[model samples]
Target: MLTRSFPRLATLRYPLVLAVALMATACGKGTESTAPAASTPAASTAATPTDTAATPAAATAPAQTRQPGPIVPPQGPAPVLGTDYEEIPGGQPWQPEPGKVEVVEVFGYICPACAAFAPTVEPWHMKLPADVNFHYVAAPFGPEWIPYAKAYYASEQLGLVDKTHMALIDAIHVKKTLPGEGDPVNEQKIADFYGQYGANPKQFLDMMQSFAVSTKINQGRQFMQKSGVTGTPTIIIDGKYRITGGKSYQDVLRIADHLIAMERAAMAGTPAAAPAAAPAAPATGTGG
Candidate 1:
């Protein structure tokens, strides 16, 4: 059965079950309460079915919020518009920017899926052309994840994401240090984790609580709210397409590459590839 209810744990987002259950909750860490949609699939019966079960037709069906698709690897064609990806109606209405396609990822430090996804997307991101600008926006789901969000903003302010992004994920998901067992949020340990990257533990700690850090965190939360994302590691391409390709994280990147091509084609005034039939409405949990 399709599970749409958010889990009660701190770690938000579902496992990559067939790529659908992504937004359905209790992910690896599991749990978070709703602030509100501020915006933001279909019910698939095959709990363990193929990843593409949420095809065009099913996508038109009204689904409960947070319905998680399955976690199967993506073994399909490049994502279909209005099905695999949801176009941000009204044109990324959130922020107005110029040039350079934007690829934004809504993620959390406590999300194991995000941790696993980092390796998959990072290498691909490095290869993208200058027209694409990629970055991450930490999701402030709850207390446990908010601190990590703070850390992310501070690190970004310090210009250290490339330097310590992997290390931080490794520290939490692998090294198993960095505090926060259940709902615990520890800044000291997180600061210590960044020490190896030339961050002064004291300055890092202070930065985590600084006004500038708070401002960035707030901005990130608003952006996430505007993003209509309820799951971690959601890849949004050029602010129009959200790469929720079913199957593998690699498929997400593959779809991203294809979409990037489409964007480039559009920019050049060339006729774009045929789009998948538009759904009756946008698919929220469906995409992420």
Candidate 2:
């Protein structure tokens, strides 16, 4: 059985705040300037300018052409810790579904940390190797968090999460709306937001409160507690390793990569290489 604990609430530190600001600025600039280069100004009409010079005739040579090399992806720095976590005596060992490493993010819809980490998490998802299974576990940290968790599962049931996930994040983070802050967590308010994305508001509300959805929310809470997570934006690798988002949002992805490698090694029945040691901290939201 998973033990439950009250979640710790804290604000992100300054360095992370600064990084988020810069990333947002860079994304905005990239979108605004993505158009192809304006047709190069037609080659100069006149001959090259020359300060008077007496020169001998030169032999004409074919223009040298350069072939572009294969595109290479940038390899950023690795994560600080490995993903594999040993079970607390008598706890279940994480076993992923066949042929895949499971990556689960334990998150709360109202968490500023989860919102801050969304953009950084996108690229990592895009680059995941084929033998990986990624999932989101919406944590029910309190009564107020239940509604949002339900909405997340409802969207998943309807196969609409791809369209709704980032939209919900943007609604909360950018629009500054607190859909998950009131008593009962405002199910209707969340449904209305989903309506804008072509989901039926009435259907969304009905489904968000159904027993089936609520059960999933409870399961998410249980999973969080089992993994020793006490905060939002925590990552559980194959249900074995737990990594929390730190001052640097990048740590989340780094830990994810480490876990993936570890899971792969274990599956192959090969001893995984040891990673360098790092500081040890309790799983109470200080960053993974």
Candidate 3:
């Protein structure tokens, strides 16, 4: 089993405060204004300005695009409504399914807090029950962050996410092979990274600038706007509850588990369980 220590909580109220503070650093370190959505002017419509000069020529086309198969999640204790998660009025799943409980994490590749939360959540996701569906919606918090988000959708289109998701995170944070927050972004470099995992660099770059990728990016932005997500590493439970408080990464998972259990019970027409002990630990760090 994965192991982590829960810091002693000094006060229940501080986690939200600390979460807010940490989320501020999740994204938007770049000096430019946030990119416009697809509805905006054409000048700003591309996910990122295509850097043709930066991309290396490709000898092969990208593999055919494919839809991703489903994945799963797990359960935990009863959680507090406002403290552990906040309800979104008229909220809907990012992608609704009839029988599965969906858990979506809104994250940015360059967000430090997201980088920190990734390892903890990666293994946690693998253990989820077969009925649960886990998804990721990449957040392009600034102009510099857009290329990474586009690369994400392109990877999804090419069915490379299952292999390269974690590696891409490492590319930005650990390996320093790709640009992060302040460094100049090269779409070619981003596409070239996927090339290592069998994606054709040219086709990947082309897909990154494709209409489908732009639509997905805009869709994600609208979902984040609708869900009130403003930072990286934020979890949405069945598109209803926005995870807003957790003293640590473990606490976040605990609350998610609790909520998942609640969702499961609701699906079966049974009452939810009594509240578990609320997480009592200092906020570990920021998410974005």
Candidate 4:
């Protein structure tokens, strides 16, 4: 017969053994942040568990990306049509008369607006069709405007305009340098710049002061006065329309296009296609 074992002692012994085993395992491991080395093969083979929640949260987060849509341009006031100044019909608006469809740009060198308009008009000049004749009328509005006009004619006479025209604009607008005001328009200064274009200094001066050149300048002044242009950068199209402000530049071109089509129609002796009847009376007015 075996001695009787206490049931409570048996139960307590297993719990005590478990506590000691856990305490021994913990004590064996140091308080450092590193994980304990795996001893058993199965423990080594198993993957170490990770929080994993942080990775999915990080991956699901939105990325920094650009917004999608068509980019809109800055808005400004709509362009106005014509000025309040005197209206001179370019004389038979659509006809291609001797001086008709003449695009006369009344400009003064000292005027910054004239300088700005120079480049815009250049390309238009190159591509101008046969019906449209373009010209630059040096506006002799004052004593200051006269010399620059003379310089312009001088450049024309010497056949040096293609080289010097843009240079003059750049000199005034970009470089902030004035060629000074006087009769004969200071050939030496222009020569200094134009010599780069193979123009002789003395010859350039002589032609600039010649009677022929002076006559051309007078003609330009007369044209401006006749056109009733009191301000510069006025674009006189077909000797029938005048565009004064910067806004008018494009309108002037548009009018020119219209006039060109009209001219072609008149030449072909064919009527333009009629438009759909309108509900209200349409605005009938002349534009540059």
lDDT (tens digit, per residue) of candidate 3 on 104-144: 98877775556656666666676677767888998775776
lDDT of 4 by residue, 132-153 (tens): 5666777554444566677788
Scored by Cα lDDT, where does model 1 land? 0.59
Cα RMSD (Å) per model? 11.5, 19.3, 12.5, 37.5
Residue-wise C-alpha lDDT for candidate 2, range 121-167, written one tens digit per residue: 64466467777777888866555556677889998888777766766
The 0-to-1 C-alpha lDDT of every candidate, in the order given, reads: 0.59, 0.53, 0.65, 0.45
Clashes of 2: 0
lDDT of model 1, residue 214 = 84
List the candidate 4 regions with Cα displacement exceeding 4 Å.
Answer: 1-100, 180-187, 244-248, 263-269, 272-288
**How far off is model 4, as Cα RMSD?**
37.5
Please, what are the lDDT tens digits per residue for candidate 1 over residues 27-125? Answer: 333234332322222232212212222221221222122222322322346567655677765446233356666778777777655665665556556
Q: Model 1 Cα displacement at 143 (Å)?
A: 0.2
Error of 3 at 71 (Å): 14
Worst 10 residues of 2 by lDDT: 26-35
Residue pairs with clashing backbones, model 3 = 9-280, 22-286, 25-288, 26-288, 27-288, 73-128, 73-129
Better of 3 and 4 by TM-score: 3
Error of 3 at 99 (Å): 0.7
lDDT of 2: 0.53
The Cα RMSD in angstroms, rounded to one decimal, for candidate 2 relative to the true structure is 19.3
